[model samples]
Target: MLSENKLWYQNSRMEETKALLLQARQEGFRSIRLNLFPAAVAEGGVDAIDAWYQSLRVLVTYGNSVGLHMIIDLHESNRCGVDASECRRLTTDFWSRTAGMFSDTRFDVSYELLNEPKGEMVSQWGALYPQLIKLVRSKDRHHSIIVGGKGYSTIWDLPPADPDQERIIYTFHYYNPMSFTHQGADWLKAHPSLAERRNIGWGSYADRTRLAIDFRSVDGWRSRNDAPLFLGEFGVFKRAPAEDRVVWLSSVARMSEERGITWCLFDYEGGFGVEGLLPAIQKGARRQP
Candidate 1:
């Protein structure tokens, strides 16, 4: 299951999106992450929104035919802007509408309530977290939902689970020691280097260990929190040296397996190219005798 942030509704055409999805499927990927933006759906008004839904129907319908699982990620609110109150309202409304949109589709799909919700502290997630899950489940009872902690979905921010054991999965993004993974990334505030280091693979090993530790702690908080875990995003910049990138990604795959976690590299093109990394990942995924 490969997950790429393919924001279909944003600055792209429907035919282009279909091509990308089909290409990904051809490249041995079974899943694609999609972000549905309401503002982008209809720049005009409610009438435009209906038209956008028609477009969505066509996209998802075609995606299903191609053996692609669409994980619909509700990303960025127009009104709420990452605040708790705003996130709650935006999440509720988004799920309510999205749930209705795909209710009839037979495609293998999942709902990611929100993408990297900010402003809320890790500890605060314990309080408002369950309510968010409850709200999503209220409308979409059968579909699985992905939930993550605050601080941009870092492993450090996941909340505990309750006794009822709802059908939810834990998720997080990994770009630890941000300087190395995000080098040359213009969007970030910092871009440090990981050059001049020996045993570079251990660096990613340690980062994955940190994620495992965080997951263990979350599990300890509530014994019933045994839901499967997935790494929704993790990638190194394209400019990084190929050797360093391979070592880092291999370590991530090994550590994730040791801890029983499923991880999908961030993308096919752009920063995370499977063409360059797949052979390395395949070697790493193999078990040593």
Candidate 2:
């Protein structure tokens, strides 16, 4: 992020994104998800945003060249939805101005409406989602849009999407058994209870049972939502024990595959690599119906 120039995306950082995407492809992944932090309206007008998009176009072009589809996520807009007026004012405008910007771009770039709608945003999502859907559908029909449930896109209680819309995929982030997955995560530990959740063991019966219950919720949501679902983000932090992290990852991977829901790991080099796409995972996923 080059804040000095006010462009959220910089060419240098894009190099890293590109390198990660290439590494993902080499490891048998075909698509990458990129997060975006939209500069505030106070920052600039259409000209400024157009400049930002121009920089982004270069990166998407490279992604297309390498046979990858990129998902552009609105990383931090969930909070805006708390104030109905602000949510309507900012989100609709954001999508309206930029959704068409990439229509003619040479790559497949999908728009993700919001990152993780927490607190008021979750309960109020139904009030906001349909409007954004209408706004984006009008601008660009060629690209797909990804949306997620509340509770930070948790798998429980997925809100059903309108039936009229097409190419709208549901997404969720997995950090189940937060005690185990988020162990040693500084941000998560700010609350005293989470601070004490570190060093939880994996591969226990309780751990497996928790996995089963969480995935069952996901399965129920899949059956109810009637739209394509995506496992948007799921990873165990690097601070956790390596064997436990792998166990958690393999469990989630198996559940997603068994149900035929596609997914993306949280990151490549950051943490939770699953032994760099172990062949056992690939072969197991292939054998699933």
Candidate 3:
């Protein structure tokens, strides 16, 4: 999924979203992640919910025509300072409406139920996921549902499937050894120095086998037996030296391809833009600098 900043409703004009979508397709991206919310919905309640659906109808139609798959991400429902019950209700209601909106569209679409659900423990995610999945299934049975575990959807939190539901795919974000990937990110508490040299634990080949094995180890039993993996989000900040970022990214790409895992770099613009990584990524040759 191409990581796009929240641009719901008029915050991002249709023209802007279209332009970005075109650019993303040109850059070999087939899917774009978007958050759905109506500005008045949160405060206005059910009536606002209706407005949100009307907006989504327009957005999804535009996205489909351009060949960009839409991954409707339920972001900010957990964070953005909302209470848990409110967040959960808004999220559930949104999906219920969303599934209905795209019920007949030909577009390749999927639902990422929530983005990086916060706090630790699988119980938190486990308690609500089955119900949310049922809601989505009720509206659209065939579309794939991407669900993440708690503690920011780290591999460690991935949960086992119900054995009944087979259409869902397990998803997780990867920005391991945060010191390296998040270098210079302002939101991070302490950024790693530009000159620092960090090593990915896999070492040497940095191939898919290592990645799969490493990821499989995160939660021990659950990830190994139950979930099929998707590296939902991963990218380095632009402030990091280009050379370092490229090396890390190459390892990610190689590993992803090897494992048959669908991997997407974290974003399309800002610190993680394709323009920033193009030179090094194009080389497709790994080297130790």
lDDT (10s digit) by residue, model 2, range 247-271:
6777788888878888877765654
Q: Which ranges in model 1 have alpha carbons more than 4 Å from their true place?
A: 1-12, 40-43, 77-83, 120-129, 190-224, 273-276, 287-289
lDDT of 2 at 32: 71
lDDT (0 to 1) per candidate: 0.65, 0.71, 0.66
lDDT of 1 by residue, 1-289 (tens): 2333334543367777788779878766777777566644545778777666677767777787899888887766333444667566656666777777776647578887777666552345555557767776666677778887765777666655454756687887777656567666665433333333223333445665674565565345345465777787777776666677766677666656766776767766665666545666658657422
lDDT of 3 by residue, 4-95 (tens): 33344443565686777777777667777775443335576765555556666677777778887888887753352245665566667777
The candidate scoring highest on lDDT is: 2
Considering summed lDDT, which 10 consecutive residues are worst modelled in model 3? 194-203
Candidate 1 lDDT trough over 10 residues, lowest sum: 190-199
Superposition TM-score, candidate 2 onto the true structure: 0.85
Q: Model 3 lDDT vs. the true structure?
A: 0.66
Order candidates by TM-score, high to low. Answer: 2, 3, 1
